[model samples]
Target: MTFTQLLRKENDDIFQAIFNHPFVDGIGKGNVPDKAIAHYIKADFEYLNAFMRIYGTAISKSAKREDIQFFNEQIRFVLNSEIHPHHNFCDHIGVGYEELQGYALPPTADHYMKHMMYHAHMGGLGETISALLPCPWTYWEIGQELMTKYEPSADHPFYQWISFYADESTGEITEEMRNRLDNIAEEASVEEQKHIKEAFRKSCQLELSFWEMAYTCEKWPGKEKVNS
Candidate 1:
């Protein structure tokens, strides 16, 4: 099996939990609370900003022009294309896309962002790809699964969101990422491969936490102190 496939197999339980999570299920059924969906979109807006920076970090570490271009294309895709779903969600809820940019990163998002950033800064291309793969990979899987299960129509409440991730183009992009990681693994040292596995596993766990965070609109434990 491909290394990416093996990683998915190892983390199958987490993937299943994400699939069965109420927040994801609600998206499939089109019954998720507006508040919860809004929380998720806002936090994800922040997350995507950080994601772009991590890609930039990867570009800096890349030796090959093709690798640099690959990261650049992904950054452009995220900036220009991937966020269409966010806009669709915002329009559904009567919020401006720009407004989401002002939202704070919730605790789970903060941790997840830091995790990716840490790997991007501290590791080589393989580790960086490992840290980054789970977000798009899992989302693609979720979208594909939801589409199969619900066969949502265009009029479905979350159809745009669902279809965005489930698009054939999205699958292609994620497959490219998997291929890149596998190629990197072939050159990775034994210790580096272990680190790559850990990074992938941790990112999977964070992906799960992100869904639960959105489900509950998770917040800090106490009120913020006043500057006064």
Candidate 2:
């Protein structure tokens, strides 16, 4: 089996939890609260900023032009294409997309971004890719599942959000990422392979937490205080 397939199979339980999460269920039914949707839009907009930085780190470590271009292209996709869903959500909720840029990363998002950045800065290409893979890969899976279950019409409140991730383009890009991770794994040291597996699993777990975070509109505990 391909490394990516193996990762998915091993983590099937986590994927199932994500699939069954109430947040995802709400999106499928077009009934999620506006507050929850707004929270997600703000958190994810900040999260994408860190996602692009991880890709930038990968590009800096790349030796081959093809690898560099691959990372570069995905960065462009996140900036230009993946962001459309955020804009749509903002528009639906009557919030300005630009305002979301000033929001702080919620607790779960902050930890997830730190996890990704650590791997990008401290690990090899294989490890970095493994760490980054779950975000897009699982989104593609979630998108496919939502589309199959709901077949949302154009007038559905979340139709644009759902259709954006379910698109052929999203699947194609996700496939490209998986293939690249598999190729990188082929030459990875045995120890590195272990790290790769751990990274992939941890990232998958974090993806599930992200859904819960949005569902609850998670935030840092307690208010900040100024010294007297």
Q: TM-score for each prediction?
A: 0.96, 0.95
In model 1, where do residues sit more than 4 Å from their true spots? 225-228
List, residue by residue over 1-228, the lDDT tens digit for candidate 1.
988989999999999999999989888998887788789898998899999999999999999999899999999999999888888788787878777676778999999999999989888889999999999999999999999999999999889999999999998888988999999998889999999999999999999999999889898889965454
Q: Which 10 consecutive residues of model 1 have the lowest summed lDDT?
A: 219-228
* Clash-forming residue pairs, model 1: none
The prediction achieving the highest TM-score against the true structure is 1
**Residues 1-228, model 2: lDDT tens digits:** 998899989999998899899988888998887788888988898898899999999999899999899999998998888878888788888888887675888889999999998988889988899889999888888888999999999998889988998988888877888998899888888899999999999999999999899889998889954455
**CA displacement after TM-score superposition, residue 144 of candidate 2 (Å):** 0.4
In candidate 1, how many Å is residue 162 off?
Answer: 0.7
Q: After superposition, how far is residue 47 of candidate 1 from its true place, in Å?
A: 0.6
Score residue 168 of candidate 2 by CA lDDT: 88
Extract clashing residue pairs from model 2.
none
Q: Which candidate is the best by lDDT?
A: 1
Rate residue 110 of model 1 by lDDT: 97
